[model samples]
Target: MQDNDITVLVVEDDDIDYMTVKRSFSKRKIMNPMVRAIDGVEALELLKGKKIGYPYIILLDLKMPRMGGLEFLEKLRADSELKDTVVFVLTTSKDEDDIHYSYEKNVAGYFLKEEASDSMMSLVDMLDGYWRIVQFPTK
Candidate 1:
């Protein structure tokens, strides 16, 4: 479940942001499999029936079409099966309400997209070590 061994599902709607992350990964030489979902609906659909190995972390955006991040989080949290999955809000929003709400939802972390860019590789590297030691349930 190392960073490279973990699958990162990025639930972001912005094309530019998606590309930025992609490019950053390449530049940083992160070997993890990265999945992209344009919105909440698509993200959920992509997750259906997927049996990903544990220590998987979700990089979620708070705003999008079909369903916003908060709504998505609510629904995701409601499902017992997905409750243990770790999620971090990776967004451009600096709004206090958004931050508070995400934390209230029990998100593992709240990361600002802009600030994250500066040390994206470092963060990914750190995740590599931690994920390798963690475990998740499988059905």
Candidate 2:
């Protein structure tokens, strides 16, 4: 990957959902490297350990086995080194409280899984366009 390429960290526990995302990216010919985590705990390990490259964005799911997306966001925002990280929530939850709290934690955007159930084209396209034009702070 190029230095400017934005790595996508997908924190999803469901195998089907993860495959759907991968298929979408493949179909769209999105070349950015993707990193997967089964849950928030693993996601934290990657981020805190700097396993993924800089200029990355997280596509977070709200429900999971260990730590859910909200808790991950809480820890992410609290960490001085990662507070500025950008996150977008993608989940099956339509709960109003989930939406409210996700934004409260400063997620860049929130999308329901139903929106991308077919091909995930919409989400993939948006992310493609996003990383193309967005800027990140230098470390």
Say which candidate scores most in lDDT: 2
lDDT of 1 by residue, 1-139 (tens): 2336678888999998888877877876777788888888887776665744444678899889899899888888888878667897888789999999998889988877765566666655556565767676554
Q: After superposing candidate 1, which stretches have Cα over 4 Å from the reference? A: 1-3, 51-55, 137-139
**In angstroms, how far off is 4's CA in candidate 1?**
2.5
**C-alpha lDDT values of all predictions:** 0.78, 0.90
The lDDT of model 2 is 0.90
Candidate 2 clashing pairs, residues 3+ apart or interchain: none
Instruction: Count clashing pairs, candidate 1.
Output: 0
The residue-by-residue lDDT of candidate 2 on 71-98, one tens digit each, is: 9999999999999899999998999999
Q: Relative to the unseen true structure, what is the Cα RMSD of model 1?
A: 2.4
Model 2 residue 107 lDDT score: 96
**Candidate that would win on TM-score:** 2
| Candidate 2 ranges beyond 4 A from true positions | 1-4, 115-119
